[model samples]
Target: MLAVHQLYGRQSHAIDSGRAADWAATFTSDGEFRSPSYPEPSTGTAELTAFAERFHAACVESGEALHHVISTVDVAATGPDALTSTAYLQIVGTPRGESSRLLRITTIVDELVRTPGGWRIRRRVVLRDG
Candidate 1:
């Protein structure tokens, strides 16, 4: 769980720095990631990679600096190799030369599994809290 949290933090940091590949590598090969705009899940490594690239491109092109804060991470071990977790997240972004504004505050529910590469996110669902 600690490793998972670190991975999430690193991914967020990479996104903040506009590094898409580093952020995308945090997920499993068959992982599924979903966001409000996605409307459906992005499945598999290729899809996730593309999604991350596009997301980062859009944010950077819009000249926004994204900052993500994650808290209240609660992990429940479902098995020796699987776990479920939920965390509260607040994301803020500012367009270049503009003031920072809240992007979203939500709960991120994740399903993770132990892999050869350590714990990798299998699925992530983001629920808006406010």
Candidate 2:
């Protein structure tokens, strides 16, 4: 459970700090990401990396820093080496010279698997809150 929190912390920091590759590395090689915010799902390492890069580029173009704030995480063990986790995600955007704004709120459900390196996300689904 502690490790899961740490993983989320690292993932959030990586993307927010513009470390695209680092953010993608938190997932498995063939990990999948599905979100209502995006038109299509991103699967595999290459696609995941591209997704992160695009996010960083968008943030750069808009001159805003986007932060993924994850909270109220709920985890359940699915197997000896797998688990499912659900959490609330709040996207906060801070423009270059303005106050931070709440971009959106969503719930993220992640399927994680224990890998030789550590815990990696196998799949993630994001559902935007109305």
Candidate 3:
């Protein structure tokens, strides 16, 4: 359970710090990211890498620092090798010479699997509550 949370923490930092490869590596080989905002889910390492890389590129282009702060993490075991988690994701941004501000808040529900290396996300769905 602690390792699962750590994986989430590392993934958040990886994305915020523009380490897209590392971010994508947090997922399983065939993992996917799903959201209502996207017409299609980002599946597999290639697409996942693209997704993360694009996000980092956007932040760099805008000269702003991005952060994903995960809180209220609730984890539960679904099976011997599977676990599920629901977390509150706070997306914050800090522009040049400006204070950090909240950009958005979404609920993240992740299905994770225990792999040889560690717990990796099998699927993650981002749900926005209106």
Candidate 4:
């Protein structure tokens, strides 16, 4: 539980600060991440890190202000060193010269494992909420 919370907190902070490398480090070497906007899932830590960098670059180029909120995490231990969890996410982004726009209200389902480096996400599936 504590591990899960810490991982979530760290990832959130990384995103808030536009620390792409830090955010990507929260995933395992063979991890997978998927989002509605991504045509295909990203696999492996290297690819994931690159994906994060590209995402941050795009946001910066757009001159948008972005914020993310994560809440209501429900974790279930799958093993002594693994767990599956789901949480709600809300994000808002404002374009360079426009008012804030709600980017998404969704749910994130993740499978995580406790590694030598602490808790790391093995798989993450994001589902948008209408």
Candidate 5:
């Protein structure tokens, strides 16, 4: 679980820095990401890569520094090699040299599996308040 949290931290940094490819690599080969920004889930590396690239391009075009602040990470060990985690997601946008604005606040539920390399997210579901 500690390693999973660390991975999340690194993935968030990668996303914030526009390292889209790197961010996408944090998931398993057959991973799935579901967020409010997109209607469908991004599954597998190719799809995830395209989604990440497009997201980074949009962020760059917007000229804002997007940051995902994850907190309150609660982990549950489901089995020997599987776990579930839920965390608070705060997506902030800060224009160059300006104050940050809260773009979205949601909760992320992640189903994770342990792999030979490390822990990887199998599916991530993002939910926001109604």
Candidate 6:
């Protein structure tokens, strides 16, 4: 559980800091990410890297900083080296020099696997809340 929390913390920091490749490294080699916010699902390492790159580019182009806040994470062990987690995610956005605002609220479901390096996301699904 401690490791899982650290993984998410690192993941959030990497993305919020606009470290595209670093953020992608939180996932497995063939990880999959599905989110309604995106036109298509991102699968595999290359696609994941591209996805993060695009996100960083978009934020830079729009002069906005986006942050991911994960809370209420419920983790369940499915196997000795595998687990699942459900978490509430809040995306807060702040313009270059403006106050921060909540951009979206969503639910994130993730399948995680323990690897030689650490815990990595094998698959993730994000559902936006109305």
Best prediction by lDDT: 2
Write the residue-wise lDDT of candidate 4 on 54-120 in tens digits.
8778888889967777889899999999999999888888888899878888899999998998889
lDDT of 5 at 37: 72
| Model 2 misplaced stretches (Cα beyond 4 Å) | none
- Using lDDT as the measure, name the better of candidate 1 and candidate 6: 6
Off by over 4 Å in 4: 96-99
**Model 6 weakest 10-residue run by lDDT:** 15-24
| TM-score, prediction 4 | 0.91
lDDT by residue for model 2 over 23-95, one digit each (tens)?
A: 8989999999999899999999899989999999999999999999989999999999999999999999999
| Candidates sorted by lDDT, best first | 2, 6, 3, 5, 4, 1
RMSD of each: 1.4, 0.7, 1.0, 1.6, 1.1, 0.8
Q: Pick the candidate with the highest TM-score.
A: 2
For model 3, give the RMSD to the true fold: 1.0
Query: Candidates' lDDT values, in order?
Result: 0.83, 0.93, 0.92, 0.87, 0.89, 0.92
TM-score of each: 0.91, 0.97, 0.95, 0.91, 0.95, 0.97
Query: What does candidate 1's lDDT look like per residue over 1-130, in tens digits?
Result: 7887887788788766767667667788888888885777888878877777787888878888778888888999999999999998888988899999987898899999998988888999988854
- Alpha-carbon lDDT of model 2: 0.93
> Higher lDDT: candidate 2 or 3?
2
lDDT score for candidate 6 against the true structure: 0.92
lDDT by residue (tens digit), candidate 6, 52-92: 98998999999999999988989999999999999988999
TM-score pick, better of 4 and 6: 6
Could you tell me how far off, in angstroms, the CA of residue 16 lies in candidate 2 after the best superposition?
Answer: 1.1
lDDT, candidate 3, 19-65, per-residue tens: 88899999999999998767889999899999999989999899999
Evaluation by TM-score, superior candidate among 2 and 5: 2
